[model samples]
Target: MTDVLVLTERELRAAVSLDLDAVDVVERAFAGLGAGGVVMPPILSMAIEERHAEVDVKTAYVPGLDGFAIKVSPGFFDNPKRGLPSLNGMMIVLSAETGIVQAALLDNGYLTDVRTAAAGAVAARHLAPATVRRAGVLGAGLQAELQIRALALVRTVPEVLVWARDPAKARAYTERMAASLSIPVRVADSPEAVVRGCDVVVTTTPSRTPLIEAGWLHPGLHVTAMGSDAPDKNELAPAVLARADRFVCDRRSQSAVLGELRSAIATGAVPEDWPVDELGEIVAGTKPGRRSADEITVCDLTGTGVQDTAIATHALRVARASGAGHVVEN
Candidate 1:
């Protein structure tokens, strides 16, 4: 008989808090990936067009880790109308040595949210300007809040400008974030306004069309587009990517197929053979990030399995230390 731990969302949340530690774990995962010390497969995605939903399966094995996680992430865009969250998922950790089931992290997508936010923080830590007074967010969802909070960990953001399709939602987000973050949060009139007014911009929408354009870019600007995880979804115009001084992605191969890089390639904005740097390479110190203060940098994050495995591993460790999960025999 084998015993496996099962961690509920509440238990996991109690065990792990989204902070620099989470960022460090994800950064190490990326470094391992860049150094070829991790075994990561291409994401397997399935679309349910009729229901406006998509499911992605992602996994990775870091060489020295005792276990790895396979994450099943499902996004049903229409679920919000039914009073349900658009995102839901879980992770299953397997023993690296014996391939035995170790733990089931029933986070219901919470861990994904934390790890993704941590990745954005890592990007901002490495790519954003040294002094970030104002940050702009192009969404009013949970991620918009989380992304800004994550950025605050690495940079000083005194104010945030937010834009959303719905004015009421944006206003509500402004109120909530201003109070929670203890900073001024204002609503921007448009996506361009948000981009122009802030040195750091984060796009967290699930838009299928371009919300930000190239002409809005300015010197010393840093953009992190985390919305386009699927082939059909795009938040940045191809020209935005083409005009950036440095363009980075979590994984070039995955980006070429499912990220903003794919959209740019599809639209002929960037050639298929164009050289794009990986965030892992920069984190691993094999490549440079933001060489100049006036450089315009952009990072395309389509999400990665390395992040999942790393975050899951960290969560399991914390949970074990805190005795936050239950052990079940099989």
Candidate 2:
């Protein structure tokens, strides 16, 4: 039997903190895909609609890591009334070699948030201008906070601007994240303000409409669109995508179906020949990220199975070392 490494949300957090190696693991997973050593199957998801809310069950298999992660997250409607997170989920990691049970992670959506945010950081590290000094985030939800923390790990950002529909929540998030990271956080009045001034902009909303406009983005700015991971979800305007010098994604197949590229493609704003390269291509030196300092770059990430496997594997290693998970005899 494979040693199952069950990890809790707290343990996952501790694991990410204690190890910079987790980032490397995730990076290599992408690089492996670019080098043709990995196979990331399409994500299969189903939505259960309710009168009050809906829940989504998603499964993805990553062949490079020889594992898969299954997740279930609920809609945002019941958050206030239930005193629970709008998103609720867990990931079950399995051994790819034998398809045996390996570990179950009760991350409560925390691991997903971190792994997705880490993807943004990876994108920024590759695509952002070398002189990047300021960052902006659109959306003040759970993922937004983690994006700030993750981006801090890569660039020397001294100031970060946050914008949310709710002024109070934005302020609170700014205060809390700023205190924790020792960086200056500012609250922006509009999404345009956040995109206009920052060298790196991250969008983590659940909006189906465009939040960042094309005109607001300056030359050399790097935008990470982490909001739209599913069909009918979009954050960046089609015009913004059309203006980018480089439009990169975690996976071309998924992004063509669900990411902002989907909207761009549907509107005919982006040409059929437009090459939407994968981040792995850049990591593998198969393609260059930023052609020039003034190139406008966009990294559209829909979260990949490879990322889940990397995080789950790292969490397992950490849990084993820290004696955090329980073992069972079967």
Candidate 3:
């Protein structure tokens, strides 16, 4: 009989928080990827255009880890109108030694959320300015709040500026975030306001068109574009990438197909062979990051399979140690 542990979202949440430790695990995974110690497959994505939904499957095997994770994520943009969350999914952990099923994490996409946010923190830690006074967020959704929380771990951000398509949503986000972060949060009238007012800007919207223009980029501004994980989505103009002093992405190949890098390359703003650095290379110390205080930096994060494996491994470890999940025999 084989025993498999089943962890629910609540139990997983109790075991893991989006803190520095979580960020470290994700950072290590990226470093492993850069060092060629991880085996990650191309993401398998399918679109359900009729429902405005897309599902992605991601997996990676780290050489030294005992287990790997296969994550299935579904995003239905129209779910909110039906009183359902726009995102939901689960992760399956498999033993590296025998490829046996080790655990099933029914996290309801919580682990994905935390790991993606942690990646943002890792990016800011390596690419953002040493001291950040204010940060801006482009979307007033779950990621908008999580990205700021993650950024606080790397830099001292005392204030926030948020902009959303709906002014009411932006105001609500401001009030809620102000209470949560213990910092003043203000609503911005436009995307340009958010970009011009803050030192670090995070774009978290699933915007099809460019929300940030090239002209808005200035010296010392760090932008983390985390929203464009699909081919049909983009948040920054191609010219914005051309203006960056340092352009980095979580992975070059994935970014070319699904991230903002695709749009830049498509528009001829950046060459297909441009020496764009990966966040992993920077984290592994093989490449330089933020060489000057006045340099404009941008990191395009499309999320990765290695991040899923890392977070799932950590969550399972923590859950087992804390006795938070149920075990079943089959």
Best by lDDT: 3
Question: Lowest lDDT 10-mer window, candidate 1?
Answer: 30-39
TM-score of each: 0.97, 0.92, 0.98
Candidate 1 structure quality by residue, lDDT tens digits, 1-330: 999999999999998778889989998998888788788888888989999998989999998888999999999999999999988999999999999999999999999999999999989989999999799999999999999999998899999999999999999999999888999999999999999999999999989999999999999999999988877889999999999999999999988887899889988999999999999999989999889999999999989999999999999999998888889999
- Listed per candidate, the RMSD to the true structure in angstroms reads 1.2, 2.2, 1.1
Ten residues in sequence with the least summed lDDT for candidate 2 = 15-24
Residues 59-141, model 3: lDDT tens digits? 99998889999999999999999999989999999999999999999999999999999999999999999988889999999
Give the Cα lDDT of each candidate.
Answer: 0.93, 0.80, 0.94
The lDDT, on a scale of 0 to 1, for candidate 3 is 0.94
Candidate 1 TM-score over all chains jointly: 0.97
Q: Once superposed on the true structure, which residue ranges of model 1 sit more than 4 Å away at CA?
A: 49-52
Q: Could you tell me the lDDT of residue 90 within candidate 1?
A: 98
